[model samples]
Target: MSLLHTLAMHRAQLPLNALRAFEAAARHLNFTRAAIELCVSQGAVSHQVAQLERRLGTRLFHRLPRGLALTDDGQALVPVLADMFDRVGAVLDQYADGRFRAVLNIGVVGTFATGWLLHRLDGFARACPHIDLRVSTNNNRVDIAAEALDFAIRFGDGAWHGTFAEPLFEASLTPLCAPSIAARLSSPRDLAQESLLRSYRPDEWRRWFEASGSPQPVLRGPVFDSSALMVAAAANGLGVALAPAAMFTRELIAERLVQPFDIAVDAGRYWLTRLLSRKESDAMRSFRHWLLREAEAETPLCSE
Candidate 1:
């Protein structure tokens, strides 16, 4: 056979219904349940799955007295079909209002995502109705290119190589704890008696102590990777968390947490970044503009 003819005969794609039928049956492991889900008769579902097995030259399932069990080959194919169908469905949903809504994917550190961005996303949605957003959160350590993200919001010095960076705001670290714990902390010196919750960054509490001109206390409490979780632990009366006070304003306002001292350590800043080679789409541009404006309203870009 000619090369092109041979390739055509063994192409990857099969009939859509056959794949769908096999996938649904594999999920439920029972023809009746799969039929109910697919709105088809049990006999039809059984026939389709059987036909799929024949076409693939292998038995996809083992007949059990109570239900079906997928073979190794069937196990491998189920997730592939599920992911493909989900992606296809997401794409189809974007076609509305006679135009496709541009999809933008972004990764954000948990602190900024929960403490600041989550509260303002409603405004972003309203302002850009034609743009669809997909957000994933991390612990300030993320690979934007590997994750296939359009942008990433991280906490650092904005000195990452091979990326474009925009400074959002300085998140000065301060001591925060529950109201009960705050009552005992008359001064920075009083923190020596309590547990000191900390993030992976080892120098935050030390810098805050330097800023307050107080002797550094021993930090042997539980270590956390995200500031949000560390503060949550503090709110639960576990310990005193040194974090960005401005980010946890809601907890302070709601009386869940208390900032015990005015001294804050300017250890790092929040930044929006993208890979140098990433091409900006219309959705990306819209989001960038909106995000920059929001950041400016909170902390002006020129304020340093």
Candidate 2:
């Protein structure tokens, strides 16, 4: 055949059903299971695989008494076919209805993101019904480029490479414990008698003790990934957690937790960040506006 004719014939002779059947059967290594998965009879699945083997001029499976095993060719094709199918599915999932719903993927630092923004998501949802919001929480180790996040709420000094970081709000850390634990905390020296929970960040507890005009007590406790989790542990009476009271105001007001002392240490402020190359969509703009308004309203007059 001429090159053009051979290419045309090859395209025309491609067996989609056979390829799909072989891919599924090879993945499962059971014709019966592949038949059930593809909603076809076992005989049909077997016939499809036979046709695929003939087309490819290679055996794809080694039939055994118990089950089936994939040949080298089949093993290689499995990942390739799987990737192709996944790409097709992802493309279809991006477009819903007649219009494409804009997606705003956000990565949030575990602390305030969970304690505050998560609780207030309903309001934002109502504001932009068409905007699809996808939020994932991380422990300060976020990759804006790798994750393709449109924006992220992170806790730090608001300095990140290749990104514009806007200050959100300052966080203050104080010693929090259950009322049962608080009853034991009459003096600074008394803190040494109890187990203290700490976060991965060093110097927090020591600084808080200095701010309170108390000597550094013997600090022995479990280190936690997030303040939210640490405070929850403290509320459960596992240990005394030094965290930001502003982040846990609801818990304090509900009497679920208490601050044992008036001392609060200044941790770095939270920041809203996005890569410089990232273009803000209309939905992101709306969210940014709403977030600034809410933050301003929440900021205490004395702090301002």
Candidate 3:
């Protein structure tokens, strides 16, 4: 057989219904539940999946009395198939408005996403009700191109290549803790003896200390994956954490946490970034205008 012909045969071998059935069954692990998801009978789902296994010459699942477990082959195929389905669904949904609504999938940096955007999302929702906004959060590391995201809310100088970065807001780091912990802090010097919760960004604590005109405390403590988690630990009186005061304002006002010192350090600005190749859809434009307006209305806690 020719290489191209064999490749075509391989691609054409898996039936879409069988793939869908397998995807759902892999998720629920029960044939009955997969049938419900597929809107078909349990026996039909089993038959379709069996045909798929026969075609592939591999058993994709290990049938258990209660449910099923994906074989190694099934494990490898699920994510790829899931993504294919998701992208197909997204494209299909775009056609509903007569014109594609232009999906803007955003991967936000975790701190600002929790600290600021979550509180203000209702405004964006009201402003652009038709624009479908999908969001995911990560630490500072994200790729606009690889993730198929049109934009990213990232914390840094906004110098990413092949992209345009617009400064959204500035964030400053300060010592924040539970009021109980604040009560124990007699002075900036007293902080040196306390358990200092740290974020993955190591320079924050040192910068806050220098801004406070205090000796940099020995940087040793529980390191957290994200600032939001670190602050939560601080709020429990576990330790003091450095974070953007603006992001943590609600917590401070509710007395869930307190800023023990006025000293603040400039970390980086939050930015709205987009890839140059990505065209601005009506939905993208609408969302951006709304977001910029929201940022403008809210005064930054610190000015550079």
Residue-level error in angstroms, candidate 1, position 67: 4.0
Off by over 4 Å in 1: 1-13, 53-59, 62-66, 69-80, 96-99, 145-148, 159-163, 254-256, 300-304
By how many angstroms RMSD does model 1 differ from the true structure?
4.0
Quick one: best TM-score, which candidate? 1
Give the candidate order by descending TM-score.
Answer: 1, 2, 3
What is the C-alpha local distance difference test score of candidate 2? Answer: 0.81
On TM-score, the stronger of 1 and 3 is: 1
Q: Per-residue lDDT of 1-304 in model 1, one digit per residue for the tens?
A: 4323432464475567777888888888999999999999999989988877776667789989998999877787778779888889878878956788988999999978887889899999999999989999999889998998999999889999999999888767778899999999999999999999988988878887888898997888999988889899999999999888777878889999999988877777889999999999899999999999999888621101
Q: How accurate is candidate 3 locally (lDDT)?
A: 0.82
TM-score of each: 0.82, 0.81, 0.75
**For model 3, how does the per-residue alpha-carbon lDDT over 230-298 read when each residue is reduced to its tens digit?**
889999988998877778778989999999888788877888999989988777788788889888987
Better of 1 and 3 by lDDT: 1
Instruction: Name the regions of candidate 3 deviating beyond 4 angstroms.
Output: 1-85, 94-102, 302-304
For each candidate, what is the lDDT? 0.85, 0.81, 0.82
